[model samples]
Target: MKFYFFNAPAPASLEVFRQEYVSQNLKKLRLAAYLAMSVSCGIIMLPLVFPVLNQTRHATFYRGLNISLIFSSALALGFEHVLTKGTRKQPPYWVGQLLCLGFAFAFICSCLGITFIAQSNPKNTLTMYLLGLGTVAFLWDFDYLETLVLVALTSLAFTLVVQLSFLSPEQALLNHCMSFVILVCFYFLSRIMYSYRANHFLQLKEIEEKNLEIQKMSQAKSEILGVVAHDLRSPFNNIEMITSLLQKKNLTPEQEQQYLGLILTSCQTSRNTINELLYLAREEQLEAIPLERLDICELLQQVQQEWQSQLQGSKDLKLLHPPAPLYAQLNKDRFHRIMDNLLSNAVKFTPANGKILIRVREEKKKLQLEVTDEGIGIPERIRPLLFERFSKARRRGLQGEKSTGLGLSICRQLVEQHGGSIDVESEERKGTTFHITLPAVK
Candidate 1:
């Protein structure tokens, strides 16, 4: 469904092929159609002016030809309007392409039809009119095949006109040569524009892609400075409090060890968060740090156990898995954060008597893990950007606790780095399910 004018990438679908092939240069296409009509009108009517300006033999015939050209242009213009409306109102894709080509076809017919209405003598009027329409074609975004077809149509039209009309041998040969030169001119003209448009579309697409990246980078900066500020500041406060305690002269040995351990854990946690922020700053992707084989079902079991203690007054939380361990290669720490984020959201949202299920399965060589919670689901308005970085994460938990939006966003990055994907299904007031897919080890 693609033709090489200057050789660009093929369209992804038939409709896409129609769009790129036809509408990419829509403005030029419109201009060509209008120009062809406007000038053809003048050429057709020029014979009527010849009677007043100079000697004219076939006065009645020229007048009739002029009237026909005017009528044809009007009819073609009407088709143009219908095609334009049909294209916009969601008609079939082919309809627009065909109508656009209809303009060219009308131009060819009228150009030849004029010959039958002209004086039976040698004059370059027909040649000029045909060539004028051809010139208009050059301004359009026709592919090489389209241009070749147009050239053939013009050649055939001129041949018919020559055989049917009265012309000297000299004039006939001259028109043929002129037509050859003009067709070649259309060839090079179409090629130049074809390449220009390809490059033009390519650069525009790249700019759009880069613009998205820049927006993400901007959002990451705001997150690091605004959302992560609390996480960073809380750890620093813990370190300061431990430092203050250390300054007391008579602290017991066990107490001192516990304080030091608390300080170490806080510092490590802060360091991990800072590392993720730095990774976001320096590169677009989080480098997949070395991974070890871990049993995913055991991982979920540990997560459920941790949540049981964390959510003491909460609803029933269950882990469902097969007897055989499902293993995958993953960075343990990052994997823990991914599961913990999803689990924490489920725990935070579920009511005291509601149910939550973390299920795991294997399908088509991929591992599927889904966390389903019967709690207040995501709002319809905010669902689209749930995993977008820098999007406000202001949803209230069952207990009215607010969340920092960065968790799900970070989880997405971590999952992608592991060659996995995450998604959520939710309905207002019904519940939410977070789904994860990853390559599984045999």
Candidate 2:
């Protein structure tokens, strides 16, 4: 709709459409020029072939005109070939315009020349002129203004030629009227053709974009299915095998307890995997999340206390924030989940007595939250995949704890859904710091 115009095309669209139109029509123009050259050659030889046409009063003049047409057509053909050599991309605007105008004028001149030589046969001359005009209109793709200019010039040329050659004033006047009417019809025909081509081009572009989108969706679906199948299979197999072992008569009480423990762990793993898959699915659906203004400093302190107690003094958890309340629009439960995942990772990686810090502040009218830990930092090689689902960077924690490889991914999804960004800074064996930035409530 933006591209559609009642009178003229928009400046940008016009340039693009013009380039395409010109590129496509260039070959046709070249072929037409070649045909013109060949026809002129034949006409030049007509006197020799028929022998009787040589005796006509204007025979010399006709031969001279045909010679000129042949020369001009050959020149045009050579110029076109040289201009278009190795031009695979769209030619420049001026070049295309020059080509179109050059061919147009050449055709017009040839038509008028023929009419002048064949004055005695006025009807046949007029028919040839009309055919030439129709071919010119149909072959070139021109806008309304260009078409109008070309048609007007053609009409004037036709009328002038008829006035100079015809003996009867009445017949000449009739020819002028017919030329005017015919040129008008050609103008509309040319416009209709241009519009059809434009519409067809736009339709092709739209279909291409839709096809690309569909391909991306299909690829993502395949990836999600692959990850789900791979992650779920191991746990399910462990549970099944453990249950079978427990049912065996040779198993002692200790073995039975150990097998039951293995089954329980497998079940827990399966449940965690399912929960993560649900998180990814929910994020993909983009369900609306409710938000409320809350003091972020107070919330961080509460989270610090919760994680600190869980650490039980094996690791020191600290909270640093501004004295004043800094408010932000946040979904409380999702925000809590983000903090829990970060803190859980921090605790799991940080060795005994290593410290964890939760920092909250306002920067440039935005809420900034950072979670830094004195733990083995991520490897440079794996950092790129750290936030990806089913990440290859996933490994056991310092305490030999398991990882679902989905916590950071879910945190990123939740933060982005709240119109925020999450990023990490880390150096191997030094430490890691995560920064979360969100819009602040003033």
RMSD of each: 5.8, 6.1
* Every model's TM-score: 0.70, 0.64
Cα lDDT tens digits for candidate 1, 137-247: 555556556667766877787777776665668887876777677667766766676566656665666688899989977866766787577767887899999999999
Candidate 2 global CA lDDT score: 0.80
Sequence-dependent TM-score of model 2:
0.64
TM-score result, candidate 1: 0.70
> Candidate 1: deviation at residue 206, Å?
2.4
Question: What lDDT score is found at residue 295 in candidate 2?
Answer: 89
Per residue, candidate 2 scores C-alpha lDDT tens digits across 1-442 of 3222225555766676777887777788788878888888888888778999888888787777777777777777776776688566666767776777667766876777677655567665567677777887778877777777787778777767776685477777777777777787777777777777777776776688799989977876776677668767888898888887777899999999888898888888788888877777777777678889998888887887887788789998889998999998888888999999999898889889999999988999898899999999988899899888767788899977777788898899899878899999998788899999999997
Clashing pairs in 2: none
Model 2 regions more than 4 Å off: 1-20, 48-89, 116-121, 152-173, 246-442
